[model samples]
Target: MTNQIPAENTLSIEEVQAAFAKSYGGLVGQLTLQNLSLEKQVQSLQSRLSDVEEIAFGLKRDNANLIKSQVTLEAEIAALIKAGPTADQIAAQGKAVIDYEDTETIASFAAANYGKEKAAPVEAA
Candidate 1:
């Protein structure tokens, strides 16, 4: 029954709904993309932290094991020296086994590698 086209500002009910839907869809898409990027970064950081923690624990355990073995070996070496041979003779035999360039200027490599942590003080003290 209308005789002329509607004005520019006038729109059908369906067109208004469609336009709103398009704008909402674009906003959702952009937010989703941003959230995905943040999620990836968070996952990467978590994985790196896990690896660092594993490495730290492994080093601590290995250092502890090395110190235990070194202590046992030192005890065995001390016992051997005390059995009969002079300390110098025992040390000379050790140098033959481990090729030390300087016999007198001995480096305590084990002591250097395994750093000591001070024990917690007793409450009474």
Candidate 2:
């Protein structure tokens, strides 16, 4: 014969302790799962931060290079202003060679008359 315990029956102290222990175990398991999830999120954030740092470093380097190039260009411009018109500038102004010829020609001049107008040699002097 199965004897049914009444719903109002009181639990002993050991039974109550066992019930609390079981509930506590479940709570601990849930807390562990939450901790693991939070740790994963932290790791993801750290990885994204590293990537952003790398991009910032690259941008910094590029900015430095651009500044250096700009400085160099300014210096070159200053030097050009100090020096007389460069060949390109003179060409742009349409100045021509001494024996101006409207037509273009190519020729190699010989040095056969070199030093002819210099002072005569000791024997001739």
- RMSD (CA, Å), each prediction: 19.0, 11.0
Instruction: Find the 10 residues in a row with the least total lDDT in model 2.
Output: 104-113
Q: Model 2's lDDT to the true fold? A: 0.66
Candidate 1 shows a clash count of 0
Error (Å) of candidate 2 at residue 79 is 2.9
Residue pair clashes in candidate 1: none
Query: What is the Å distance of residue 107 in model 2 from its true position?
Result: 28
lDDT of 1 by residue, 1-125 (tens): 87787687689889999998899999999999999999999999999999999999999999999999999999998898696555565566556437755433223322222322211121112
Model 1: how far residue 122 lies from native, Å: 55
TM-score versus the correct structure, for each prediction = 0.43, 0.56
TM-score of 2: 0.56
Model 1, poorest ten-residue lDDT window?
116-125
Candidate 2 residues lying further than 4 Å off, grouped into runs, are 1-9, 81-125
